[model samples]
Target: MTIRFPTLSFAAVRAELLARREIALLDVREEDPFAQAHPLWAANLPLSKLELEAWRRIPRRDTLIVLYGDHAGSDLAPIAAQRLAELGYTRVHVLEGGLDGWREAGGELFRDVNVPSKAFGELVEHERHTPSLSAQEVKALIDAKADVVVLDARRFDEYQTMSIPTATSVPGAELVLRVRALAPDPATQVIVNCAGRTRSIIGTQSLVNAGIPNPVAALRNGTIGWKLAGQALDHEASRRAPEAGEANRAVARASAQEVAQRAGVKCIALDAIESLEAPDRTVYRFDVRTPEEYEAGHLPHFASAPGGQLVQETDHQAPVCGARIVLADDDGVRAPMTASWLAQMGWEVYVVEDHPTSARQVRGAAAPVHPDAPVVDEVSVTELARHLRESPGTTAVIDVTAGVNHARRHIPGAWFAIRAQLAQAIEAIQPARRYVLTCGSSLLARFAAKDLRSLLKARGSEAEVSVLAGGNAAWFAAGEPEESGWKNVATPATDRYRRPYEGTDAPAEAMQAYLDWEFGLVAQLAADGTHHFHVI
Candidate 1:
């Protein structure tokens, strides 16, 4: 059978970017390779999880999309195009020359994930001249016990890992609304920091843009700057900002609204939001509030997307560029402040005007993306454990989870395999009489088991293939034995991309290189004129 995919040329894609038209340029390769070098706006949607992720990240089925990848002679881009068509995506095409074609066409490529937002941050600082104090200057004030407060703008977990001494976790979107309450005295100087440059610059500028009375500055280069300066950091820091009082809310609300207006963010109501649900257009509804506040209660239709992270990870959250976004916030401050950033990033963004006070329609975490699970035989955790212990070597356990998680821990002697390469992974392991597949909760394993069963059938082998009833999570709960480290790997561990700025794994040299790359983003943004970013 002939498998033909419509192709989009690099020149055409570049034209769309330059025109500021809605286009989602996707790379259908594993994240590791995709992160190495791709066009500025390209989002990684690996073919392995295309079905699992495409419908959600791209809520609009008819969105204009162009895909490219290093197919390794596998024709992955065409396969992805067909898959998208089956999922009801109307306008899908393969990139004519893929990555090489992009380079040949004089297209600018960017490294690392979330390049758009990071580059926009540099542009914001360049245009607005956002204020900053070097790590040395910030340390001097702290050592002197001067009138200053350090607010870490990264996520709480990242802050808990390692943070500046006496720094509190108050993520980006919360900065504008919570700053006044956190530092009531106008005399106190406020400093913001993140894992790297983007959030710190955005967070500090948010306060400055909102016209907060306190003096503010970003910790230059963020925690990386602190580490390079040879200063010790605090681990397991639990300090956080308190909720804003009514007086502070009033001030934050008014300030945020003005900033949103300046950035061209729109105010929308429920009826207007419903009208956007037309068949031809895609609209994303995100509640840009704290997860804890959202988990307590949120509108049934809205997903929990904290404002700061949404701006940082727009590619991950809203992969479809140019899609309309409606943000919901009960406080009337966080959503507008978040919307302001989105507006500046060339998005048609809005904040709900009549956000519900009693947002009790849904509770707990955002509902997991619901895809039809393929039915397969199941083995209970206790049964698998008994077989592995009493009758060792009879059954081979294949854990179909993220490589990082599998390396951290798995059933004793289990082999880690990327589901996309399950056939090759199965062949690499010593031939087994039976196979049991498991993931964090068996959700993904269920799908992999179905594929494994068909592979065995095609080979005329009657090997039994079953999904572990509760997956890895259930096994640990049952006190099943486990082991760490990689063994008998079929494919390279390229599923997850390790950020150079994250954890202590990256060396000082790599950290310096990351900072150097950030410092040059303004120039790159100029070379690739698709980004319609500006600052007030």
Candidate 2:
């Protein structure tokens, strides 16, 4: 059967991006290669996980999806196009000539993930000239016990990992509303910092844009600069911003509204949602509150995306560039502030006026809709444990979870295998009487079980195949013995991109390189000319 899909040239896709026509330029390769280099706007959707992620990430079935993945001997885009076609996506296309074609077409390539947001941060500073203070300057202020408040604009976990001395966790979206409570005095010098420059710049700019009463500036180059300056950081810090008072909330709302209006963000009430969501277009509804707040109560169909992370990683949150985005927050401050940044990033953004209440609230995370998997044989955790104990080597357990997860924990001797490269894994593992497949929740394992069956059948092997009833999570929940580390890694763990800014163990050189790369993103954006970004 021919896998039918159109081929889009670089010029064509660029036109769509510039025109504000929605398109998801997906690099259907694992995160590792996709991170090394790709078009500035390309989002990573590894072919192996496409079945599980495509529907959720892309959202709209008719979205203009352009995929490309072609390495020396492996070509994944065609296979990915077929898979998307099977999933009922009608407007799929392959980037003409794959990544090579993109480079040949003179496309500006960027390294690392979330290039759009990072580059936009640099551009924001360039255009707005967002004020900043060097790490040494900030350290001196802390040493002097001056009238200053340091706000960390990264996720709470990231702040807890390693933070500047005396810094409080006030993630991006929470800054405006919570800052007043943290620093009631209008003259207090407020300094913002993140692990690196992007969030720091964006968070500081957010305060500046919202007209916060206190004098504000970013900790230049963020923590990376702090480390380079020979400063020690606090570890296991638990400090966070306090809740805002009613008066502070009122002031924040007014300021955010003005900033949003300046950035050209649209506002719509709950009742007008139908009009905002045209069937012909894609509209993403995100609740830009803390995850805890969102899980307690949120509007149905609204996914939780903390405002700061949403701005820092827009490509990951909403891969369909140019799609309409609707942000929600009960306080009315976070949503509008987030909308302001997204609007300048060239997204048609909106802030929802309706608030979530317990009367009509939906609890917990928004689960993605997944296609039904073909029926396959299954073995429960207890049964698998018994089989492993009794049958020994006859039943080989293959763990099909993400490499990082597999390395972290797995059933004692399960071999790690990527679902896309299952055949290679099967060939490497010795012949067995039966095979048991599992993953985090068994969701991905169920799909992989079907693939394993077909591969075994094609080779004319009569081995029995089964999926672990609830996968690794169930196994762990049942007190089953687990092992850690890269044991029996049959396939390279290319599914994840190791972020240079994450984890305290990152080398100084790598962190400096990451900072160096950010400094040049503005020039790259200029060369690309596809990002229709602006600054207020």
Candidate 3:
């Protein structure tokens, strides 16, 4: 039986956005393809990993979800709609004529991930005339050891990977808070940069807006421009912004509070957060601190969304364009800095003022397991190894870890499969009497095992399913043999779309092309004319 889904016209979707309605215009395609061309507000929720991310990205099931894909040949919209419906989404629809239809209807398509945020950054620069110095100019200043400090406004890991010489790791939100401490002399020149334009522009403008005494400018085009200018970049540098003093903290609190207030951001307490939780509104509570800090301890019910990455990838972080976002941090700096950008991006954002004094705090990156998560039986890694040794063909091991992690190291003979593609993955594997699921930790594998059991039960198969206790780490600790590479992959590892600017091997041409695309986003935003951005 063919299932027909409701179709939304491109014009209708545009109207919905213009009307400020809660809509998730999703493009269920792999990241690389989706980045090539997509509607400005279309969130990339690839069908391949829908089960793993859909719930978090689009929290409300009743949200008006209109999915589209490459409609040139193969249509993925209907299939995605079916999957979303199965996942309990009530108001699911497919875009009529898909991408082609949107193009025909005069919809402005954007290239690259985080289109809305990047475009907003460009708009901010255009409106405010954010100051910037070219790579050569900044390099000359660094060579002369002038009264200058270069601040890398990217994540620490990104800064460690590659950065401008003499640049300190001071991520975007940290700029306003830590700059005073880093540059005590008012005559000092402060330069901010990231791999590309958005963070550089945002970070440089942040200090300027906060009335920092130092002369500030962005290292134009960041490390990319540095490399392009035949200037060498420093790798594995460990310089970081110093901790703010009481005086610095007081100043930052005042500056960030003023910025947040000007942006219409509300200050909410923990009790207020609880009250905001409702069936009708989708609220995203994020602790916009560094991952290391978040891992040390953070408030319950708040996910780790490092301030810099959250702003860079807002579309990926919050799919519902008009959703309310509440940001939290131990200090008053990161949350307000993050909330200000979110506000300018058209979200109803807030900063949590009260600290998590009495609230529960957890360690590690894994979010607390949902109460409704399915329960599955578990077996020890040693037991699984014995079973594999005894009945090699009868027992099958499925490693439902991230594709990149699986490629690095996995249990020998374990087939790599994404949790979202378990049903199809099981069918592709040779018939076995039993199946074992595992990830880096058993947390995700247990959920995968439950899914596998459901798929088996639906097919009336008697195959037993269980999660590997302690997962692949336990298997390695027990001295079990392991393998590497993409051999025996059940699904193509389209789970993560590689960024053009990530890693050292990206083609120079591609990087240049990416920069060119970003440079034109202001014009694209002008053409679209729907983004309600108000720079503070």
Candidate 4:
């Protein structure tokens, strides 16, 4: 039987996605293009890995799925819908012309999945929603020392390179999750700002809609607006957010504990970890550190897997759910935090006991290295660069560093690949060639190179892999030209990850209270609205 699929113009598709609840918007573009920018609800599940990687995350056989690709000649749209149908998904649709169509329809894009512009548009449409002080008003607030929290919702790197004075980088998606962490004082009003209108509006309203107890508003037009208002931006700070108070710290500690208990997770010393490798059991040893750290030197047999995401999505990370998962970290920060969360997520998680000075030295002299590990040769790198400069087939470079370093300066062609998204991020890449992995430091670049090489080999590809000898730091140190045209790409997600207790339909009273808290955005809640909130 011929399948007659649903088709809609980009405008119609987006309207349906935004107006409806629980829609899955899938972008079949290769990772680089997807990273360039996309809609908030859209997720990148490349057409290549549609059959393999997307199954577990997108299990619904009848999801209201919308697929798109580059407007040019990419067949990803129909192909993806076809694949989803084969996987038993009954309702599959495609955006007529991909993002180009959206742009043609004057639709805006965002940097991260956390902020939904359509939702923001809804907020702006309401009578009660007021624009925060314009750039002029904000500058006055800064001048008057007003009690407002101005948050930069861009990546941390952008915040570090240039940002409004006293601004904090609370990445957009994390805005709601980390709201309490950012604004502990109930009396402090919150202001969300991004580079432009879309993220600022979306970021602000997302916090409001998520039931944050703060009077929330967007920076009018964002940083650009601030600049046009003749405001001077600040740059290069070594300062970090001060440690939270005892109460907040306690919450973090407790959250970690809950995560650990739920996941059946534990932390073990290096020696204890050493005893568990039964040789036959497929124990996955992951190094939850930056690629630079991993490459410079990592524990023997340890593959690079950064921490933030390891905890957030454990199942996608540790496929062997019951396998003895061992993590390696140079310091306790990520390892413990990650282990605690993994435990909460139902994993048998553990951290290697202390014995090595650095993550690299954890393995003894006899640890086996994957046979096809990438080689970090200077000669090979020079040849690769020349090849890139010459014919220039699509080549992608990732700069995995703190937001500050990346914003200040990064490799010319590298896109943002923070360590957190390493494993899932790879699916965004085309399976054609081995990647040129890079980071701020050579350690991570080397680690990424090896990891990518191993991944390719496992897939039966003989792709050549290499790492920049010194990463982006070296690229800058060598006097390469640095440009300021880095474009923020849109990242999309599924409603599947959102956990609201009870059911898909939130209680109207609870939702009313939630809207009230988020709408007025009073920093602290009185006894009235607190009852409806339950952490899922």
Candidate 1 per-residue C-alpha lDDT over 2-30 given as tens digits, one digit per residue, 9 for 90 to 100: 45878999999888877766788999888
lDDT of 2 by residue, 1-536 (tens): 87667899999998998888889999988888889999988998888788888888888898999999985478889889999999999899999988888899899899999889999999999999999999999999999999999999999999999999999999999999999999899999999999889999999999999988889999999988899888999999999888899999999999999999999999888767768667768888898999999988888788899999999999988999888899898988999999999999989998987554653378887877779876889999999999999989999999989888898989998999988888888878888999999999888888888889989999999999999988899999999999999878778888888988777778989989998899999989888888888999
Superposed Cα RMSD, model 2: 1.6
What would the per-residue lDDT of candidate 4 be over residues 144-182, giving only the tens digit for each residue?
A: 988787887665665776677888876553454455767
The models' CA-based lDDT, in order, is: 0.88, 0.90, 0.86, 0.55
User: How close is every model to the real structure, measured as TM-score?
Assistant: 0.96, 0.97, 0.87, 0.40
lDDT order of candidates, top first: 2, 1, 3, 4
lDDT, residue 368, candidate 3:
41
List clashing residue pairs in candidate 3: none
Best by TM-score: 2
- What does candidate 3's lDDT look like per residue over 411-462, in tens digits? 9898998676676687689989999998987777876787788799989999
Model 3 has an lDDT value of 0.86
Candidate of highest lDDT: 2
lDDT, candidate 2, residue 115?
Answer: 88
Model 3 poorest 10 in a row by lDDT: 366-375
Poorest lDDT segment (10 consecutive residues) of candidate 4: 527-536
**Model 3 compared with the native: what TM-score?**
0.87
Model 2 alpha-carbon miss at residue 227, Å = 1.9
